[model samples]
Target: AQTVTQSQPEMSVQEAETVTLSCTYDTSESDYYLFWYKQPPSRQMILVIRQEAYKQQNATENRFSVNFQKAAKSFSLKISDSQLGDAAMYFCAYSKDSNYQLIWGAGTKLIIKP
Candidate 1:
């Protein structure tokens, strides 16, 4: 069984600063996809970033990026210059195919301090 774990239940960062949310997963498959999703107050799941296990390079989108360590089974999200809008529940997920079915982690609520 594949599972994702987020050690931090909550994280805080000052506006204009950077914050990293830690996530780890256990999987037997060699090839898989990892994703970071953010759900704001409106309850909309937004794709932050994604990483392919077979790829050596990390994935990034705008101020969002991921440190994907396939060997360690760790995928952490880094949000640069975080704004008030970045305050949301961030979830880490693992999938074998596309975003159809995903094994998700206990999300971390991000607090942005002004």
Candidate 2:
């Protein structure tokens, strides 16, 4: 069975600072895609970052970066110089090319403190 765990249910960081949201996943597939999505008040899931299991380089998008540890099955999201817009429900998910369904974690609510 595949699963993702986010130990922190909620996180708070001051504006313009950095915050890392921890996520650990369990999967048997050697090749898969790890994802981090943010759902704001609008409830739209925005892709923050994505990483391939086989790729050694971490994926980064603007202020968002991922610390992907394939051996440890850990894929954590890092937000640098966070802004108020960054506050949202952050979800960690993983999916294989063969499987269209995404296995998601209990989202962590990020609160940006001004």
Candidate 3:
């Protein structure tokens, strides 16, 4: 069974700064996919970023990025220039393959300090 874990239950960041949320997973498959999803107060799941296990370079999207360590089975999300809009619950997920079902972490509640 593949399992994703987010050690931090909650996190806070000042507007215009940066923050990184930690995540780890245990999986038997060597090749898989990782994803970070953000759910705002609206409760809509949005894909923040994704990483393919075979890729050596971490994925980046504007101010968001990931640190993927395949050997350690760790994948973390980094949000730069954080904004109030970024305050939300972030979940780390894993999938055996692109089309397979996802394994989700509990989530980390992110609060933006005004």
Query: TM-scores of the models, in the given order?
Result: 0.96, 0.96, 0.97
TM-score of 2: 0.96
lDDT of 1 by residue, 1-55 (tens): 8899999999999999999999999988889999999999999999888888889
lDDT of 2 by residue, 1-114 (tens): 988999999999999999999999988889999999999988998888888888999999999999999899899999999999999999999898646699999999999999
- Ten-residue region with minimum lDDT total, candidate 2: 94-103
CA lDDT of every candidate: 0.95, 0.93, 0.96
TM-score of 3: 0.97
- Report the C-alpha lDDT of model 3 over 1-114, residue by residue, as the tens digit: 788999999999999999999999999998999999999999999999999999999999999999999898999999999999999999999999978999999999999998
List the candidate 3 regions with Cα displacement exceeding 4 Å.
Answer: none
- In candidate 1, stretches whose alpha carbon ends up further than 4 angstroms from where it belongs are none
Candidate ordering by lDDT (highest first)? 3, 1, 2
Report the candidate with higher lDDT, 1 versus 3.
3
Query: What is the lDDT for 50 in model 1?
Result: 82
